[model samples]
Target: MLRESHKDRIQEEIGNDEIVTGKGLNQEISLVRAEDTRWNSHLKTITSLISLFPEVKKVLEYVEDDGDNGASRLQASGLLSYFKTFEFVFYMHLMLTILGLTNSLSQALQRKDQDILEAVDLIRTTKAQLQMLRENGFDQVLEKCYSFCDKHEIVKLDMTEALNPCNSFSQFNKSSLLKLSKMYPRDFDDKERMILEHELDIYYHFVYNDVRFANLNGIADLARSMVATRKHLSYPLVYRLLKLTLVLPVATATVERCFSAMKLVKTNLRNRIGDDFLNAALICDIEKEAHAKVKTEDVIDRFQKMKTRRGQI
Candidate 1:
């Protein structure tokens, strides 16, 4: 309602003009109403809010002070109280900071150029950075939060007070975590050296002796090499592992794409098509390059060979 009422004014002020910042986001972008179905959308929503925080605060204040109805005014006041708080401001910055790190990692994982080793290294680096942040950067984050709160005119909380645990009743066993961390030895001591030797011997005995995998670069390379050489039968365990790394779709993106392609291929107009026909049509539509490679004459010959026909074109 607030947006609708002031749409004309907002348009007049912004006028399709974009305000570029660090993220290259435009100030003309309106505040997004988040939905549960699209959880990642909340990240974008938060970003937009942060970018337009000043303008948004002004609008919220206007609604609270000048709303036409009591209900609108009350709602606006509640929104202002909720938004302009130390907790909200802190959490907003916290999420933004964390998500910025994870977004890079996510993009790295999504890249075709990233192999398992690189991805694993990226994960370890990100994990270490997060641990470092938790251990040493809390004060810096706190200072930033304080700065944001001051800018927003929200009262700062007492920093000396003990921080509240997420679950007061839950017991966190720090000793157990320490013990678990020790399971993966950081230094190659006598015991660690023996463990590493045994593991390496077992691994090399199976995979290193295999000539076909001699030049395998990464998991992706292993999958392709094994399949190309038809050596999957020679090394069952290694083949299985490599196959999983290659064929297993991590993000449901491929499945979603297939479904979307199915919708286009098997629409209401072709709803009554047989299951086999639908599958074939979907395959052709989805695999456009492969379908393009196939000649029309070859398809005609294959159709004719399937069964006897009254006439052939």
Candidate 2:
């Protein structure tokens, strides 16, 4: 095979020396090949994993999947996977990029390959989008840096309180969006324009889901406020925490799976099980995956054999 087999050759290619730059990296990058646990945060780990599928960049490259408004483009499908792969890296770059780090920009600019540079710029654009939380006179400069709307639709908003979800999205309507778009200052920068536009678009979701999120969802409320000001918002701590927790249902499709499992187990043989027993049995039956490492084939097989013998009698 065309490969480096020796420990030395492989280590040489993946060595610490090749890590080159650690611009936004916090942890020390290490080389891990066979069984080293330290590879989790290494440069090789980051790049190799991102490199596994060139398809990621392709998703970002797609400008028009749906024939919708030309102004709105889809975020890269690879970008989400990139998110799963490198949240810390994304945030680190976000911080560096928003702060306008000379080094970070330089690394991106230094890439002679136009394609890579453009991709890096696209990634930077996403990471640098910023939303501010201003309630009345106070400005709580939000740290989750990101942009809002695109150019051409710049707008200004005159708001009172820091808009919460109830006051923001759920309450927003299409007419309000048009009004926000009208408020754009003539000489606004690209980012300002985008933020204002993003806020308006965000308002639509709130208008649709007001009933479901009337007062319960905390993060949703905060996002709704961003809609009020006509800027897309990102709450780093709260959003990440909620995302990880909510992902099981929203992202994983596990809720539908549980219902399916319930139907499967409650079929004719065990249809008479009471509500209490039915719920418990469903839980235990679906959670067999947790004991996957724990072998119990022999116990189950014996139980089945004994049940068959008794039935024979």
Candidate 3:
């Protein structure tokens, strides 16, 4: 609702505007403050594997079998062995690493699949790994908050449930790949599309059936907001929907952090800063922990010496 609302407001505000967009806004910060970390956390698993397991090289050999269908990812139950090697990472990943995984897995419990059980066990073991590493792992842990999704936002079909429908539950064999070639127009051998189709269908069902989609609801809502309320500016209705559902207090933590750093750099002494100068301040602030980091004075000095540099340094 909020995102849809935002979209309307934005569109109204930018009647003829087209600014830079699509994941370019502090891309790293966006990942850090994501509304959903499932995809990123999955990538993080590789890091966890590299970090926690000293025996990662040994484990890689076991995870190296061509799957039943020759797909080469992981065979059914074949993933079990690899699952164990990094089993210790689960709880740590869950409690300490990926909260989105926890939520997704918990919801998967309804299916009663052995894989889900394994996943839960995996998370538990990861927690145990942390426990042994520390006296109380939970202390370092912040219970994963689905604060963004938990409120007004409605959840769509999750991964597994989405793929495995009730109709196809009885049969081991599933649907075909060629059905929606346009959507999955990629050169890939496979029924992967068939699997995806099931999941996507369920996701759409949840969106239309569950969320009561107010964004695409109509022009009346947009007219009311832009012309009547005149609240948020020309943001389109669709963008508004995405932002509202996704943006929780946690989602913009990176942005907030950047703002804090910006405030420190662009203080009264640096208040003569240009937009570009302020942007540089944010960049330097974030890279403080890394090598090749930018210096604060470099920016501060530039601003202090600006043509508008009338302020007392």
Evaluated with TM-score, which candidate comes out highest?
A: 1
Report the C-alpha lDDT of model 1 over 1-313, residue by residue, as the tens digit.
4354345545554665532234543224667886433334556788878757767777879988999999999998998887876657766876666656555665787679888998889888887767666556656666887887787688765332211112331222333222222322443345644453444345445444666656544455655665777766654443443332233112223444577687787778878989899889888877888899999999899999998899985
lDDT tens string, model 2, 1-313?
1121233333554576753435563232332352221212233444443233233333334533542555534444435443433233333333333333223443454467757757667556534432221111112111221121111122322121213344433443434333333333343345554554665455446544656445534444555544564444442322222232222111122444576678787888877889898877777767778645545776577777775565521
Locate the minimum summed-lDDT window of 10 residues in model 1. Answer: 160-169
lDDT of 1: 0.59
Candidate lDDT (C-alpha), each: 0.59, 0.40, 0.39
lDDT of 3 by residue, 75-170 (tens): 534544534422223233333333333344434443555585677786586555444434433222322212212321323112122123233222
| TM-score, every prediction | 0.40, 0.20, 0.20
Error of 1 at 247 (Å): 40
Give candidate 2's error at residue 81 in angstroms. Answer: 13
Off by over 4 Å in 2: 1-36, 40-166, 170-313
The model with the greater lDDT, 1 or 3, is: 1
